[model samples]
Target: MSGFKTKKISKNPHQNPMQVSKIPSQKTGFSSKNTPENQKETSENILTSADKNKRRARKISGIFLIISVLVFGAIFAIKAVGNMQLSNNDEYKTFRQITDIFGDNSETPKTPEKRGSKNILIAGIGGRGHPGGELTDSLMLANMNYDTKTVTLLSIPRDLYVAYSSNSAGKINALYPMGQKQNEGVNLLAKKVSEITNQPIHHYLIIDFSGFKSIVDALGGVEVNVPKKIYDREYPNNNWGYEIFSLNAGLQTLDGKTALKFARSRHSTSDFDRSSRQQLLLKAIKDKALSLGILTNPAKISELIDSVRNNLSTDLTVGDLVDIGLAFKDMSNTNILMYSYNNECNGICMPGSYLYTPGRDDFGGAWVLLPENATRSRVSRYENMRQFASLVFEFPHLQNAEKSIRIVTNSKNLSQAKNIRKNLEQLGFPIDHQNAIVQTGATIETTNIHKYYDSAIGTGFDDNHILVEALKKIEPSISQSTGTGAKFATGTGQYIEIILGNDAKNYFQFKGISASMTENNNFSESNKK
Candidate 1:
């Protein structure tokens, strides 16, 4: 396609209550109390012209009210996106003292006695001189709507492809690091997102890792299940991190440090898995803080407020936040909206199918639409923010176990599926599904092994199409199956699955050939075709 198209949804601005009422000010030449009891004697000395003018003035005032009412017709709906409205007066203090994003003296959100669904983006940064490690470990787009007495918390995967909504044409997280210089990263990300989701970001709550830890500690702690041990010998150290979070596969309470690990660890599983863990922790903290009646207890409330104020940065006032928070105090888990970028891209493509890719020339040539998870509507808006939504998928049946993989080009000799498969199996995966398949063209699968493995993790994910670039390097000798590539369902839910696409099963081997990348690292797609 020459250019991507976006879908737009507009909201009408809310009309002012007083505007509709249109009450006009009233004052005549004299007040009724001041009117003379002897009207006949007073009329003899009065200027008839002046009296006539006073009567006309009253008529003009009435006309002014009528004009005000007429002007009310021009009023519009007020739409505030990503604005955080506090549930209680106390919660307001937590926001003001804890956040710094609004600057030393900036206009922060004011409190309105009544509240509505206000959206907020929570960014977890590694602050101080170490902010260089400003990898946003957790990104939450929380929507609190008092109208429905519900809250929706959308957790975005750190690695999902999102347009920085700027000159940066790639991932959304890059907006932060790129922002270090422009000083516009976070805001830019918010703005771009506003353009993308059609929701304006009201306030940004950026927390340093320590502050995050403090908040968790204040909440008593959070609990999570350790899927695998993450040991990064070279992991950053000294307050930053290097220590591995080792835990058996079970539920356990996590202190600040452990909670940090729970949010940041990606060791062996995918970033998708890490996101799930953080979401679980967020819920745990919210539950502990609200259900335990932490706010209701004076001493405990005081301590939490202290901890929260100590760690958070924002532009919201204490009173405004307090009232907003109180409004939301009655809300439960289901009342929340959880928006996932992954879920947005799910089921957008067909499985086992290969789509055209933007060869190196496209960045210099035509805009190519690659097959992957993503909604066309979302892609369009993000594209305006200068980001490509192209996704690559590769899934080949493992054809050989001994050679590990056999080679092949399409009958057209356009791909290298076999070589890559061997590399992946050597990396160690039970990649029999790819090896056993014989077909090469597009197809769909009913029972997917990938979904089975994904569900095993409790994330319950599935994909319809395979990633092409990640696969082409693999050997075609892998068995081909009667399955399509990764296909995630929209709104309902989204997930990446391929029965171990010959490509992903082999990601470890490629990592070596390439270089080691952390959770925040993004693989380069610049080396087109």
Candidate 2:
């Protein structure tokens, strides 16, 4: 049977009304567990109680502050000794203490070099306790342009099939663990990710499950908008037992465990949603830590540093982090751009879906997602990845224009219609929701564009300069329909009408099989015969 065969997995009747991005699986069973206590209580009560506690803590903090000042002075006086070595000096001792609490400190700080862009690959592992805990659960590439202060977060799916070496082929997440088994570790993983993205991974940060939870707790928890209620009945607990985990849809502050659940829960949802949740949780953690003055308060900073020490590893020194913090301190939430690859677009799976194709591993016969035909790129996955990296890093301006586009395809090829829409969406267009797509089965001979309700305006002109300019990048000679019609009235500044013709196969760089493909294959087979 073809790997694309439709399959259904049992769902709890009480599951939320929101649809999940369907991920096919065999032998799908609960792997870990969470307790009933992990269930999220209504956020309103939690927030009210938290506010009261904060107010109370503020009222009594002065007493502790006064005592600490006196004790610090007394200790300094007692420790004052001449002829103390630099290593034994109290100032040096405090510096070392700070360094230890944080990961590491740069020995000799240097002037910040003017690098046009910086790329950092951040990976999160499940950590020590849980089964397969050491494997990376999330991997993201952060591309920051220091001059513009704009950042792009590109999330690579964990199940992406990448061959780290000629002899080794596995999920991208396994690269780190497999490296560790060979005693090479994260460095090797970084190299592999860099190669895949076709961009240099200047630095890497690996956070384990403990570090993630601890840091969130240190910051008094993070608030995230759970868009839809999540009910993972068989959520994994630490004891190898399943527990029901449920969270209501709302804006709520999540403590360490709850935040982890919000980010890591994948029973009903697919990895795309999980990646998005992880990104949201990360922003929430940053916002909370900043709001709570952890970055400014020495004590809070020390506490957080100590909390994450064992669970975080990175070559980034304290100085490096401080430099980064100061550079992007003024960046607001809007300055950050996020993109992820998904299995489907507009309720239709694109030809040769981006999600990995499941199959048995050649080495062990264990189930794994494998690359059959081309995935991201028409020729190879590597080409596809590099194309994505270039678009992200080189054309950072794409994020600047938040274009809400509605695509209407007039093509007999349903797959081609879906494919074009998927490509446009992948280019970071905010498609006007899922139901916005209109498919007209009528086939034309050449692709034509109707721009802003005007057809005869010119061969290739549109009042929406941004849309026209972006389209020119793909097809320079793309022409307008050259006739005024009621259909042209449907065009908006954000919307474009595409009448796909047979020639569109060449225009969109069409690769996947359709009527044209079948004919080509038949001819080739007959030639072989």
Candidate 3:
């Protein structure tokens, strides 16, 4: 197939239209009592316009007032974070004071805030203590939707392969060091991430290991549930040596030091597992901060803010931070969704299933994960991540629906079945290997597609229709029919099962693209492929 042909899916007739109402602005200024009653009436008459301009003017004025209030509130919140009172209305004093508090360099300009959904890239570095301490230890993106009160955290693995300037390539973490050497490390890293994920990062927040530990300590530590026993015998010690880091399975409250270890440990497990632990730890930290009422405690808040000021560096202003803090105050654990691009779940091993592990002769045998498309087409990891980000930010409703459709092929052509599955998954559908529906009956059949539903959930005609429409986009000849046999209705929930036939072999063929990669710090496609 050349391309997945777009189809016109019927809309859900029962979908409700959400209505929003605007608040009418109140008149604040009072008329002078010294004015004559007739003069007041004359003034009111003159103010009134002949047409709808009066209402339009009021709306314009109301919008301006709201913007002014937001700016004022943001500034006030910034001062409050540091336990500083907004005593006088002198703008210059406030500006100078904020500049001093945040250590704003006169040479660096402020980061401009976007009007819509904001994407902030956060980087955690080792910072001045350890060898290559400038290397990023943790990298995550916070995508915040101001109107929806929703947040999605995406973690980018440090070991992923990325191309730098002048055709130099290395691990994703190296971007920071390379950029720092060039005198714009943070901005360069942000630019590279934006290129990789195709999502523009408006601002970046950088904090070293000390700041992370201090912030946790200031918040009195965080609580987490250990899913399994974790014992890392090779955990790094401060003295440039290795030590054991163990945690028993169960609920436990960890101090700053232990929490940092829990997040950074990666001896027994892979980087994928480490990414998961970091996300869980973040959730626990948020929970602990809320439970301790850190926002309400001025002393603790000031200390925490000081920790940030002393150790953290960012282009975002105090007011921007305040605006973010206030906007997402009500966002709880449930409102947060997390995603990571690992070897599994929309990622594939370059030459095999080991993620980014290199061949013996390549890159001095250094391990790296290469990003590939459904057809094994060489593509940038950022391009792949951009699609995932779109699903999180722009297509939440479809993503929720897409996760429900599970494809199971019964045909002998495994290659075609796998290709179809990959295409569907790239489109945001959740297709799991464990959930792959197997064919038990005799294999005499043509290609058939159908939806399976339960009485408890009733008929998912709308969702099923969407699945069928998407399938038709890929294979225009798909026949939508009921499960006339015993095989289709076995699944519990709503799912789409594709019984592949010999016709699939003719439709899908994988052209082996031999990836001729050289043995250097950077990897790229060769013309020989």
Please list the residue runs of candidate 2 whose C-alpha ends up more than 4 Å from where it truly belongs after superposition.
1-115, 345-353, 359-367, 370-380, 393-418, 432-506, 510-529
Question: Higher-TM-score candidate among 1 and 3?
Answer: 3
Clashes of 1: 97
Where is model 1 poorest over a 10-residue stretch in terms of lDDT?
A: 385-394
- TM-scores of all candidate predictions against the true structure: 0.45, 0.64, 0.65
Better of 2 and 3 by TM-score: 3
TM-score ranking, high to low: 3, 2, 1
Best-fitting candidate, measured by TM-score? 3
Model 2 agreement with the true structure over 35-75: per-residue lDDT tens digits: 24455764333545545774465334423333443455322
Q: In candidate 3, how many Å is residue 32 off? A: 53
**Per-residue lDDT of 2 in model 3:** 14
What is the lDDT, from 0 to 100, of the residue 122 in candidate 1?
74
Model 1 lDDT per residue over 133-161, tens place:
45555676665555567555555554334
Candidate 3: regions farther than 4 A off: 1-116, 345-354, 373-385, 392-414, 422-428, 432-435, 438-493, 498-529
